[model samples]
Target: MIGNYLEFNVFFDIIGTIAFAISGAILGCKKKMDILGVIVLGLVTALGGGFVRDLVLGINPPNMFQNSTNAIISTVFSVLVFMFFYFRKNFTSRQVLIFMNEFMILSDTIGLASFTITGMTTALSLGLDKKFLLIFVGSITGVGGGMIRDVLAGTIPFIFKEQIYAGACILGSIVFLLTRNFLGDQVSMIICFFTVLIFRLLAVKKNWNLPRISD
Candidate 1:
């Protein structure tokens, strides 16, 4: 059903899953998790967002679990990422840590963008009409997995910790809704996906952040 309209979306889904899986594997390694634990984190990070969204929407069984494609994809990527990190064995080096951290951030950002668009498209297809629900669903699909991954990894969630994480997702979701009337569905999704991606990248590069109260 979803595959029909999501001609190119499935591809983004695979890429996003791989990206998030790698990020999860990196975090799991940082937390000193074993291979099994790392794999669990990767799977959760890849699918947790959709799981939450489905539960909220009463989509029993969830889409990822219904078919084995995404699960298999995530698992393979997780194992490959874990092996790469294991073989490297240089986490202590400052340069190595910096490079790995940057890479993780980049992967996370890509996943966030891909998932945001996917979520909005899915919600629209589901006949969900409210703007808030669309944004909320999109945001959840974008960051829900990362939230679970961070919690399991014993660190602050990126959506909460990063400068403009969920904000970027929200903005992208809004863009999708706004452009729906004026643009084709495919074009709208692409615009929204890039909106989140480019926005997050710019925010990170420029150190843009929401204001925090005095400490």
Candidate 2:
């Protein structure tokens, strides 16, 4: 059961990585960044979460270096996506926005859920006891890539201002922690993913936001 759960998690991680890489490439293209910049954004978005996770875990130099497959996959996928957009530069803003809205929603949801679960799993393996630490790690893993991507692209990080962005990650981590023992690990993961995704989409549809205080 554990082995199957691990395998599924790894598969979701790869898919999430590719999706985020595509998102980064799309954003780079929108900003009229050079090809090198586009590739950089893609690489950062794809690997940034895992890189941070490894660093926090003290896995010196990181698994991104140890695992050549991940690096190659991220690079190849990014380049292909950039090329696709590069050839379609004539697309209107409305068309672009439509595409971006759909793409970002899908990619961000997957990335958020996968990273949250992975972060929680890592924290548990590392013997972290605090529930809040699970939430923090999960939120960081989910948003770290977009933070890096936005910084590199000279834009505000979406999660800091966007509607209920990191909320999904927080919810996902909570679900994972709460249900890990009651359900099988794989079942728990699936439930967490769907819970986060559904909540995120609903938040968007409803334009949900936390209360703000005026300074």
Candidate 3:
């Protein structure tokens, strides 16, 4: 059971890393950043949340430094995105921008769901049984990287003002906590991931946003 859980956790972590890297790379390309900037943005978006989570949990060195696979994966993907954009004949075409925007949303949603699972699972594996802490860590791991990416890209983080982003992660964490014991870790993770993914997609489609003071 422990081995299975570790496998699942690592699987989801890699998926999240790839998705976030692509999203960050897209943002970098759109921002007209060079290859180095794109790589930096991609790596940050792919690993920043995990790094922060480890710091919060007092895990020195963090997993990224301990294992370089994720960094290499993110860097390779970022370079691919840069090359694709750089070599495109119509890099600024409206249709291409639209497609990239759509792809970004898909990647971001997948990353959000995948990382939420990884965060909660990591917390549980460490023998931390506090529900609130699990949820908090999960939410941070799900959204922290994207938040940093947006700030670096000079835009307000989507979680703060756009469609239900962090809210979806928080809710997903809740779902995992509620179902993990009864349904087991794997099943609970599946439910939690889909919960965030569907909720985020629906929010995007419906233009859902929290009530603002002025709005």
Check candidate 1 and list the clashing pairs. none
Q: Of 2 and 3, which scores higher on lDDT?
A: 3
Give the candidate number with the greatest lDDT. Answer: 3
| Candidate 3 residue-pair clash tally | 0
Task: Give the C-alpha miss distance for residue 70 in model 1, angstroms.
Answer: 1.1
Off by over 4 Å in 2: 1-4, 126-130, 213-215
Q: Report the Cα lDDT for residue 32, model 2.
A: 78
Residue 173: error of model 2 in Å? Answer: 0.5
lDDT per residue (tens digit) for residues 45-102 in model 1: 9998888888878888899879888888888888887787788867667887887789
Candidate 3 RMSD computed on C-alpha atoms after optimal superposition onto the true structure: 1.1
What's the lDDT for candidate 2? 0.79
Each candidate: what lDDT?
A: 0.85, 0.79, 0.92
**Model 1 error, position 14 (Å):** 1.5
Off by over 4 Å in 3: none
**Candidate 2 residue 196 C-alpha distance from true site, Å:** 1.5
TM-scores of all predicted structures: 0.94, 0.90, 0.97
